[model samples]
Target: MNRRISVAIDGPAGAGKSSISKVVAKQLGYLYIDTGAMYRGITWALLDQEIEISDTAAVKAALDHIELQLVPVEDGLRVLVNNRDVSKEIRTQYVTSHVSQVAAQKAVRTKLVEMQRSMASVGGVILDGRDIGSVVLPDAELKVYLTASVETRGHRRWLELKDKEDITLEEVCRTVADRDTMDMERKESPLICVDDAVVVETDHLSIEETVQKLTELIRNAEKGERHG
Candidate 1:
């Protein structure tokens, strides 16, 4: 059997990590794991059960019985919690606003990170999240830290949700900024680029361009590994 390679993509919210990672994974015939969705899945459960985000104990206790599963569909992956599909529900503004708090909890991070590691154990996986490169998959074969201007990111996010929600550009920008602060200031596994991670700035690049650039980077890295 051919050895599998693990790719870690990390960045702040709205940096296009998820969308780009999915295309790159598809091109390489690798599994794409959206770690952010896993956290959002937990947030969905907490909201569904009315568990207060401020109550760390309640959140930790709730996680004990919560099960998160990622099922691949024709378009992308669907997140399931306890056999029920909550994929679309988890992406709401309410959930997005509260997910940072849930993700900051040490217990929640520990559980989800373990599951993520297990899923990528055999490699051939592209894991994307705020802390994938720094925390979840530090030893991954290739680590790419993707980033873009906050304004650009906000615009991308707004475009994705303008029809579904009554949000303006200013609101989206503020939300994106707030998320970056929370993600960077969090105590556990805060978002940071590891030393060896190659940084990819996508401020001026199209999605296809970003994916093609990353695919080339991965291919070169694989070649170097084989030649070395």
Candidate 2:
């Protein structure tokens, strides 16, 4: 039997990291881990417990009691906190606005990285997030830095929200810039591209196109995989 492998896909918001990662994982028969959602789940826990984000010690303590889990489903993945369904809850406007602060916490990143590594130990996984390629899985068989123009990303988010919520294109554009600022300025694990990382520009590509390119990258890498 062939050994499993790890793939890391990193990108800014609305560049289709979540959507592309899911489709790519399904095609490759690999488990997909959304590190962003994991951070959001922890943010949800902080809000539920009325813990303040500024207090680092308090935030770290709160995380000890909250357990985050992911279960694959027909629609996508289901997120659970303490084994309770919170997939939809974490995507709310509230969580969307606050997740960055929660994720910015250094202690929080340490804990989450530990969990992500434990899950990726056996491979057969594709992890997507801002820092996955640079920090979480630097040794992944394949690393992708997926991105699109700020305007394009905003438009995509606008359409999604217009269909399901009340977010405006202008608002999303601002959110995109804000996230980029915070991520780039962050002290711990700022999102950066290392040497030899493949960058995918998705401004004009279809979702299928993005997945197809990534799939080929993996197939090529698997040829060079090491086995005992």
Candidate 3:
């Protein structure tokens, strides 16, 4: 029998980590945990209450009212906060611009990391986030750092948001660049690719191509673990 192992996929925003990881988990019949969505959930809740995120004390207090859950559906995962589904709401421009600030909070990271750790304590789980390989799942059987050029990522993000937002491509690219700097420079669980992580650059690859590549890597990882 093949072993069921934890897989950690880490990368910067708009790098397709969440989308690719979701598909990979489905193909492998593993549990898919979207750590980024959890942080987004917190960010959304804070905004809903009109709480000032800069006030660390208020943010810490707001955590008590937030209850996040990731429910699986035929289409994909549905993110819930306090029993309210905010899957689409959390992906809004407001949350996207502010999630980094909320995520950087020590209190937010502490609470969400605990939840993430509990969800992945079992094997056959795949998690995608900034610090999954570096902090959340250091002992994961396979660690993949999926990335692409900032321009590519920005273009992709712009494509996703063009219909919903009134932003220009240039503005989207600048936002992506700024997010990269903030994510890399943040003090709490900043985005990083560990030495053991396999870096996959998707500058020219289609989604299908990337998924196939990761699926093959996962199969090889399982075999290597069996022998080792």
- Where does candidate 3 stray beyond 4 Å? 225-228
Residue 64 in model 2: lDDT: 81
Candidate 2 runs further than 4 Å off: 1-3, 225-228
- Per-candidate TM equals 0.96, 0.94, 0.97
* Error of model 1, residue 36, in angstroms: 0.5
State the lDDT of candidate 1 residue by residue for 1-228, as single tens digits.
445688899999999999999998898888999999999999999999999999999999999889899999877899999999999999888899999999999999999999999999987899999888888988888888999999999999999899999999899999999999999999999999888888899999999999999888778666655312
Highest TM-score: give the candidate number: 3
Q: Which residue pairs clash in candidate 2? A: none
Q: Determine which window of 10 residues in candidate 3 has minimal summed lDDT.
A: 219-228
Q: Which runs of model 1 end up more than 4 angstroms from their true locations? A: 1-3, 225-228
Q: How many backbone clashes does candidate 2 have?
A: 0
Q: Which model scores highest in lDDT?
A: 3
lDDT of 3: 0.92
Candidate 1 residue pairs in clash (backbone atoms < 3 Å): none
In Å, residue 99's CA in model 2 sits off its true spot by 1.0
